[model samples]
Target: MLRTLLKSVSELSTKIDKLIFLCQRSAMGVIDRRTEEMDSDAIHFPLRTHEELRSLEAALDNKKYRDHFVARLRNLMCDDTRKSAKACLQYILSPELANIYTLHGTRSKFGISKYKFYSTVQSALCSHFRSASCPEKEILHAMATASQAFLHDARNKVHKRGWRSKERLASQALSDVTNIINDTSTST
Candidate 1:
């Protein structure tokens, strides 16, 4: 019975990790959209002093324009990074996690209780974080990289001493959901 429980936990962890990946990708899409908008909104320089400008333009080349555009592009990128990081921070702070916790009410009746399930999830998520070779690492890295802008503020609040990653919290929620579904399947 415990072996089955562990298997279910493993599968739940995988599915929840996938959901985290989807959310991170959606956040990146937002960043990419901002980058495109910045590119399209580039300012056009007015013709500066016709005669002197002609002589100056011949000597100036595109360097000045290129440098200004690059600076603007970097600013846009920074803005996008900040926005995405804020969204991710909000996600981590949301009270929706309580709803996730409620799914495991029945699991308490079994030996597979909430704390144990949470521990399993925490272990899996930390393992994935430590091993960059994991399939979920790319998604985790994208999330961490985008969230760097907010880390100093969010690092303390996202997780308690028990779990370190959003992935772990999400996985615990999924394990509860899977247990509920399996209970239904057995009943039918």
Candidate 2:
């Protein structure tokens, strides 16, 4: 009788283990689904320049991510030894990247050929300021200015325009965005 009781207990334990496994799997599924919903939320209701500008403004106003991005830009921009911001845009003219676009099926773009050379520290810093027409380097470069004009334009939306080079700005915009933007990373 004792042996019979032990066997029954063993069976019960096995069933309990299976139940625990199922519960854990179900919980994981719920977590994954929740994560997907949050990510999709960002997409279905994407953060436009106006919104990001607002969010960034709030963050800067509150002295949040501003500290990180501000310090990074200060370091990157002060290094004149590095290539100019416009020079970085040369990738926009590349045959491989230019001919192909990964923008949403419909959106305006920066006319790459139309970009003008930036003159002073202020202009270069503000070239892509509020327009959000320029590349990441330009964005980071703009932060380097710490110039009132840069912040003023961004705050006032002085150069509001379609976000061009979606391929560079939005990750979902392009399949090869990493290579497209960091194409110059290998050189330096």
- The best candidate by lDDT is 1
lDDT of 2: 0.36
Q: For each candidate, what TM-score against the reference?
A: 0.20, 0.22
- Residue pairs clashing, model 2: none
**lDDT at 42 for candidate 1?**
29
Candidate 2 residues 1-188, lDDT tens each?
99999999999999999997656534433213443221111211122333332332333332333344344333434333123332232211222232222211125432222222112223434443435455556555443332223223332332344334445457665657767678878777
Q: What is the C-alpha local distance difference test score of each model?
A: 0.39, 0.36
In candidate 1, what are the lDDT values of residues 36-102, reduced to their tens digit?
2222122222212233222222222344443443343333232233353334333322322222222
The list of candidate 1 runs beyond 4 A from truth reads 1-152, 161-166, 186-188
Q: Best TM-score goes to which candidate?
A: 2
